[model samples]
Target: MATVLPEGTANNTAERTFDSLNPATDEVVGTYPITTPAEVDAAVARAHDAARFWDELGFAGRAQRLRKWKSIITRRLPELCALVRAETGKPEGDAQLEIVLAIEHIEWAAKHAKKILGPQRRSPGLLLANNAASVEYHPLGVVGAIGPWNYPVYTPLGSITYALAAGNAVVFKPSEHTPGVGKWLVDTFAEAVPEQPVLQLITGFGETGAALAASDVDKIAFTGSAATGKKVMATAAQRLTPVVIEGGGKDAVLVDADADLDAAADATVWGACANAGQTCAGVERAYVHEKVYDDFVAKVVEKVGTVRGGSDMDAQYGPMTMRSQIDVIRRHVEDALERGGKAVYGGLDSIGERTVQPIVLVDVPEDAAAVREETFGPTVTIAKVRDMDEAVARANASTYGLGSAVFTRGKGVDIARRLRTGATSINAPLSFAGIASLPFGGHGDSGFGRIHGPEGLREFARPKAIARQRFSPPLSLTSFSRTKATEKLVARMMRVLHGRSR
Candidate 1:
């Protein structure tokens, strides 16, 4: 199996590793390897060696092992949740919530892998009447995944579980900000299946991730900024490795005229503020119908003000996981205010070095920085639209097409369908991410390829199609034993079949 001796284990090279610090507290949590391209190559070679053994185990065997891993995770939920909280500085409840969703995905991937990816019969087309056809999804050997810090457990596990279920060995590079969370995960996997290192962990900064990207992995699954996603793609391009790039987004929420204002407000506040507004699919902008704009904004502010950010147990949320992001959040807020925006709730004063209270801006311009750029913080910009059509047009104006939401009474589902995004929640916000069976991903600047559901399983596996001649046909088009008479007959048959349509 593929394995890397974690830091302080066998390869105690202190100079080559870095500290994993709590961005919220500025305290060192753990130290991990700064993996070089050479190390990445070694890891991928190990994973390649393990992949054959894993594939030979077949679907039933793999599913059993995956279920075992899931059991281990569920049994030790509290410990893992605490580790996540410490590394990411999220509230305990929020950490548990994300881990619970990750567990669901693992369960779903285990139970559905065989049925979704195993060989099945395919229809023989008219041109090959005597041929029997089938297709089976085969594992793509070793996969490399570079994960993000936001929702560390959930985001990375979405790739890791689906890859494992599809019978591929994985070499995971967890974010520098959340190495402890990554260590806990990999250690548990090793414990669950000690005989085979089907899952492995490597830790470091951007250079380590870039090294993995350029390594000889069968496929790359990355969840990070679009800028880094492009770099990953470029590095993988050297080896012609396929990749699934799930990048950032500037998602929006549309509030229709007849929508339930209270529900919309509640969903928006929770979606934008949950995880300290560090969510990739979080609602950063909202377009409300003019008829109910006043009431909707009022409710959003009222609910958001009640939420608090702190490190204690009673707080609703916690500090920002990355201190640098605090400045990014502040820049967007400050720019909006300078461009004639009004702060209905929290503003520049709410942004602290460690934590940021949720900020709500009103009447921000369409071209303003806050509205155009991705502000991955607990912030939202509200604008009044003439109608639902205008709301959707304004929402789709950006270069992002990740996750979106629509709040409406009778036209909720219809409006959601109209939005040009990968996932949409009608009358709810970021709810699609929780459904394990629904494929989660985005398009345009949000990046392509899915990380959940059957699509996700197939992302790490390649389809192998088979065709066999079941029986002999009287008219054999594929045989070279045909004379001019047979050729004439075939032409006549083709004419009969398709001449009228043409």
Candidate 2:
């Protein structure tokens, strides 16, 4: 029998329930109360009520509370990791790493929120020179977050931590596959600020998430599949609500002819197999210079063969949390095989009941589904090119451009900048995710807006510009009293400041 949620739990609507299973054992671990539409609305209303109190606290007070919360999370990091591992079936070490990184983001946001979101003076321009102008960021009241199961802690915390630091209350709806992780985070925040409902959780299936999107929240921050992101945006359009969508990625890693083959292979193995290849920025395709293609493929195959997947401690990877993902992984492998791609390490039979061993493919046609789409599995398709130019062209051919990496010794930075993605790292894979200062997001089909660093704080707050006249100017332009002489002066100033020839 499936587990049932406990009655009278906080935020429980008692309308429906869903089971969270241990991916490794296929045993039901726990049941979460599926919130109804009314409950989602109630959570939003409570967030609005809490926002007034939270916004009134200002930056310093809010920063202090965030610091305290950060301390709490840091001290209990292991406990939280256990919950994450249990709910998401990720390795314990990986879970711990995500929590640590999340804490770093929280600390950084708490320390820098004021500097990033505070009021600042701006030039009123010559036309409004008589008026003093300043702009300040205001809270968006309540923000609703619909997160993903992979990297459950880090992905959602990217939005939640920044939103709270910006003085906006949050109503988080974690992935149905990982509600326990969500509940643990919100419960910890509640312990820090028991007086107000600043952070709340509403757990349920897609309907509950849809309800939250359609509700009256000021903004919605969603991190999931691109398809669901489109649905969320469509629903929010009804009320014309603002949203920041951090969807999927088909990111690639380019290895130039001058690159170190061994280092490139190591990075590829880790990037493709880590977290069971569930990372949004994880490398799904690899473009290698044909000059060194054979050496790179051999090393990657050797390295991937050393890694295995299981729930046991000795294994390097774990099982697929969602059963439906098995079919997708199998189909991608089958498609690649049929399209003339050679599987160097594993094949279609490598996909087990729950665990999927790492699969490395080489000589894959660029148009293959495995190369063109977001597999979100521990599979990588590597192709060969004649030069750096061809490698770059093949890398940029995809529709999604979230995060990418380059492994050349000297030209890594230049190549990284030209990848048409949001974030890129040189010599290392997924290193940008660790830096709290750089903005994390994507472009094109990967989704719009950002959710980390300064951009994240600004995303949760609306800019409010204040202008007040301090003194009368020698030449006025706003009033009807403006003369041709004043217009001529303005024109001359414009020509001086913004002339066609610099």
Candidate 3:
């Protein structure tokens, strides 16, 4: 794989580098340059220069290029998925699913950027009735996106694609674990828009990421652990660079008594185990109504029992993308077990060399690490709640609230409203992530800012407000010419409009 290098470093034979390994077999998939701080600066400078051309392209010009990029990705779906599977160690289908969602987001961002970010008329209000006001979103120049390994394509592109569509150049530093996948995306983007390096890639370890954060980018978009997010924020603080951090999530699921048990079980199991539960928004803990706790637990356990993780094609999922996370899974399971939790399905033995089989823990205390922290493994804790009220309370009691799910026949929407998460799915798990029209991101420890939807398109751009005088105001309140009478009239108007007893 070709690693995009800095201008002066092309001939440096002694440049540092690192190898990306396939988590399953520990085989070296590819080697990437450990981009130096100077190289990162070079990339950011190039992005800044490119941003001028990109911004001048205007909405229609940018959308046309984005659509071409999207079409290239759609046609090469199989090839991209193969690279994703090789780097991330996820099942082929799972990789494809993420790419498909990414493609949809690219389409949405391209088609909607004009409508969402274009200039729009705003009501002038009574005081300025003669003035025409409008707001338009302009690109933030250059965006520095630091992606995560688990959902490399879908997550990073969430920022990269949208930033490009909004007419900004992007300097992306994907996860060290999935550099190949990141390189593939950048390469394909070059294929689509070769005139300018609107999107560039720099691969390395945490040092490289920090360099990009501290660089002179207009905005920093990071997806990783909250601890790391804090570090990114601190680094970017030096420049006062704006940032959107999509941090870790300890998402929950609420199963109401009236929920379809079979459907709920299916959603919960798939949500918890899909991609080996590496999903930031995956169901890490679930609260079931007492009336259906026993039945729901049985269903979840039975489904989890049959699921397996391996490198084979028939495996339900593949190994953990990052081998170090294996210990985190082990510790959480042990902690839950020591805290009186019982494994209804796979247990301690499920934790393997690089893969974790589905493990469902019941009776795990809400305060247990497994239930409170982001395990990022195929393990979920189920607890019984007396009522939906209790379930909602317990579910909302988390520092990280990225995404959530509520299963019910009658109260799905109502219950979803009470959730403190970024996005909540009714009768399903992770449904919000697939919808390009819905914004993604979370509150508190889950981080702030959104990534998908109309809100997402606006995230990378700055709003510019304009007010033009359509005609001179008859009252002439601002003029020194007879302003007292106009001021009195304005006060009376304010009273009539706002000072109402009703």
The alpha-carbon deviation from the true structure for residue 108 of candidate 1, after best TM-score superposition, in angstroms, is 0.7
For candidate 1, what is the lDDT? Answer: 0.87
The digit string of per-residue lDDT tens for model 1 on 1-502 reads 1121122222346577677777667677777777777887888888898888788888888888888888999999999888888888888888889999998998899899999999999998887878999999999999998888888999999999999999999999988788888888989888876777778888776667777887889999998887778778888888899989888889999998889999999999998888888999999999999999999999999999898887777777788888878889988999999999999998999998799988999989999889998899999999999999999999999888899999988998888888889999998878899999999888888899998998999988999999999888777677788678878988998899888954
Clashes of 2: 0
Can you list the residue pairs that collide in candidate 2? none
lDDT tens readout by residue for model 2, 1-502:
1111121223344546777778887567678888888999999999999999999999998998998888899889889888887877888998998999999999999999999999999999866788999999999999999888899899999999999999999999988788888998899898888889999999877678888998989999998877778888888888999999888899898998888888889999999999899889999999888889889999999989899888888888788877778888899889989989889889887899888999998767788889988898999999888887887888888789899999997898888878889999888889999999888999777899998899989999999989998988888777899999989988998888888785
The alpha-carbon root-mean-square deviation between model 1 and the true structure, to one decimal in Å, is: 3.4
- Name the candidate, 2 or 3, with the larger lDDT value: 3
Q: Across residues 1-502, which tens digit of lDDT does each residue of candidate 3 receive? A: 1111111112235868777788888788888898888999999999999999999989889888888989999999999998899988898899999999999999999888999999899999988899999999989999999998899899999988889988899999988888899999999999988988999999887668888988999999999888888888888888889899889799888999899998899888998999999999998889999999999998887887778899999899999888778999999999999999999898999998988899999999888999889999998899999999999999999999899999999999999999999999998779899999999999899999999899888899999999999998888877668577778888999899999988
Clashes of each: 0, 0, 0
The model with the greater lDDT, 1 or 3, is 3
As a whole number from 0 to 100, the lDDT of residue 491 in candidate 2 is 95
Cα RMSD, each candidate: 3.4, 3.8, 3.6
Predicted model with the maximum lDDT: 3
lDDT to native, each model: 0.87, 0.87, 0.89
